[model samples]
Target: MNKDSAQTALLWIVAAGFFMQSLDTTIVNTALPSIANSLHVAPLAMQPIIIAYTLTMAMLTPASGWLADRFGTRRVYFVAILIFVLGSICCASAHTLGQLVIARVLQGVGGSMLLPIGRLAVLRSVSGEQYVSALAFISVAGQLGPIAGPTLGGWFVQDMTWHWIFLINVPIGAVGLYAVRRFLPTHGETQAPPFDFVGCGLLSLCMIAFSLSIEAPFSTHRAAWAAGLFVLAVVSALAYIPYARRRRNPLFKLALFSEPNFSVGLIGNLVCRIGSSAVPFLVPLLLQLQLGYSPLHSGLMMLPAALAGTVAKRWIAPLIRRYGYDTFLLVNTLIVGSSIVAFALITRGTPLAIEIAILAVFGAANSMQFAAMNSVTLKDLSHEDAGSGNSLFSMVQMLAIGLGVSIGGGLVNLFSAQWGSAALGFRFSFACVGVITLVSAWIFRQLDVAPAQPKVRAPATHSAGR
Candidate 1:
């Protein structure tokens, strides 16, 4: 193929890889109840299935770039697709929650590699001028996954079974595998650097400890033990900072946070996403368990949010340009947080129009919030630090998603016990998460208003991080 056509094919191949990974993230959210039912577990207890995938991704992400460099990108990409498909099959066949969580971890092992390696491939092949368009094109593909995942999952669960939700990945993954072989160019493997096994272990332990701490209230752990675990988590996480500074080549350089925007944006992204991320998981549960919406209908309700987010992309640049990042993020963060809280207002008697409006507003604002946050975080990175910086950002994003599910689930159970009402529990969880989101505004407010450059769109990498 000619260079242009070949590059186009390469973008699609990477996009397809992204689509598969992205679809799995949301697709499972809608099917959580059904899967829980089939496994004879409580629907509320299904957070591990989601947490396992994200937490594993976060833990393993730092290794992906190194893996691509050690093993050629094409080879690693191919294996990633293969392993993800196999994990999907295992998930479909799972008879217990434990088995499914194990399978998801395996799936995450592959997914953690797919996009980073594929992006690496694109970076090596494409010229600088073409990079923006290429990334934009791939990002649009990533958006399609969120758009399709919930509805497709609901349809699969309703028409067939929850197993199909996983089985669906098989064919897509197989196609991706073949496309990688055919269209993807092979790259020379670089001299392998010494892997930071110690640093990675510390960070992984930190994430697990913190995540389990939030989840402890739901489990049999005592409050004191939970508090202790949280303390341990903080210690382990803090230990990594000092370790990174001492090491010659740490997994992530401590210096990356020196930029004001990077520091503010990363902190803001994590806090903001804790609330936003929980919404997807919570909404399905609210609609199905509380409002008595069918799985298909509940999934369909998500369409407005996805569609509005897509349509709102154009408005982001203009909005940011007019108000600047500081002003835009501060105001939009409130809108996003408020939109989340408004979901508590939805009841059996609530108007459908109001519900859709709430979701749509949150969708648009949240999308803008993400693109702006991502751009600002990476905007100040020097080209040399770009890869590591982006990888670190993506890792934190995944960590936040896992934390969001854990916190949201734990809150629901905590409230359910305290209030003696499941409906009240869901409502309280929404309000609590909304408040958490609002707190992130202070982080955004720290951004300088002068350098308030607008990001037209975020790359597939950041959007995929969502």
Candidate 2:
């Protein structure tokens, strides 16, 4: 057909991939209890399932730009779909916790490239006039996927098995694969640079050590091991900073951070996200472990939050326009933090409806926080900076998510040890995390109050990453 039509179809394909990735990230939260029960692991121990996906994403995300430039977007997109589909099959077949974690790593390997490469493809092919709108459309679809994922995952798990939540990806992935192969534009150029093996290795090691350190308390309860990991992480990171600075072509350009707004927004995102992302992973475990709620019941309880988050998106932009990003993020961060505390207080006697209401409010604030933060982060970045900056932000987002779940889980274990009550541990953890979220208000306070210009939105890649 026409080139314009092909471009439109191209975005649709990428949007499908986005939806699949988002759905996978969120859907599993509700299904975690069943998966843990089936595999005979502690429900609290299931944080790895979430960590594996996000950490893999964090580790691999920076590589996508290079891969896409070297391999051509069409070829990479095809491989991405194949890897993702294979990952889904592996996940469905997993019979043990280790197997599932391994399978998630594979899935993440595929997913890590999908959004960034796809966005790069669009940015390369689409005219500037059509660019943001295309990105916005894909983003909305991706956001809506999470809005529906928990409810649908719960339904599938309750009616069939936890396996089906992943198996469902096969069909959606099939559609995505076909669409990418048929509709996506081919890249005519090749990137001539060789990959940076040393830098990649050091960076990967740093992320792995940091994420695992967060979970160390839960597994070994050895503060010494955790302390060692912290030191290792510091070394690995310090090595990368100077190495990246010295390199002619680093894995990520150090220049991206020189943009004051983007740099600050990136750090703000990581901090803000750790607080919000921790809740999804924590709430499921709290419901089933502390309150002894059934998997189906807990999933049902989370539905309101997802629903409210969706409805809140429409209002987020207007709110941003009214108060500006600084005020919006500062205020919204408090609301999100408080919601985590509310969930922390949950127990068997907690009113089901009231609990749902609190979660619903939490979801809305979280959505608004994302929309605002993402906008401000990218607001100053231009087309040239888009690739590395977005990729860098995406990496931090995943890294934060991994840290959030791991750290949050570790806190749960700590409180459990001190309080001698699973319920009390969750409450204290929630309050602590809540206070952490509130402190982030200080992060946004640094932003200047520039009134946002309301405009039509398009295909920005939305990540379920923190």
Q: Which stretches of candidate 2 lie over 4 Å from their true place?
A: 448-466
Q: Tens digit of lDDT per residue, candidate 1, span 115-223?
A: 8788889999999999878877887778998999999999999999999989999999988888888989989799989889889899899889988888886776589
Query: How many collisions per candidate?
Result: 0, 9
Q: State residue 191's C-alpha deviation in candidate 1, in Å.
A: 1.3
For residues 369-420, could you state the per-residue lDDT of candidate 2 as single tens digits? 7777777776776787776676667777788888788778778888888888
The lDDT, on a scale of 0 to 1, for candidate 2 is 0.80
- The numbered model that scores best in lDDT is 1
Q: Where does candidate 2 have its weakest 10-residue lDDT segment?
A: 456-465
Error of 2 at 129 (Å): 2.1
* Native RMSD of candidate 1 (Å): 1.5
lDDT of each: 0.87, 0.80
Ten residues in sequence with the least summed lDDT for candidate 1: 456-465
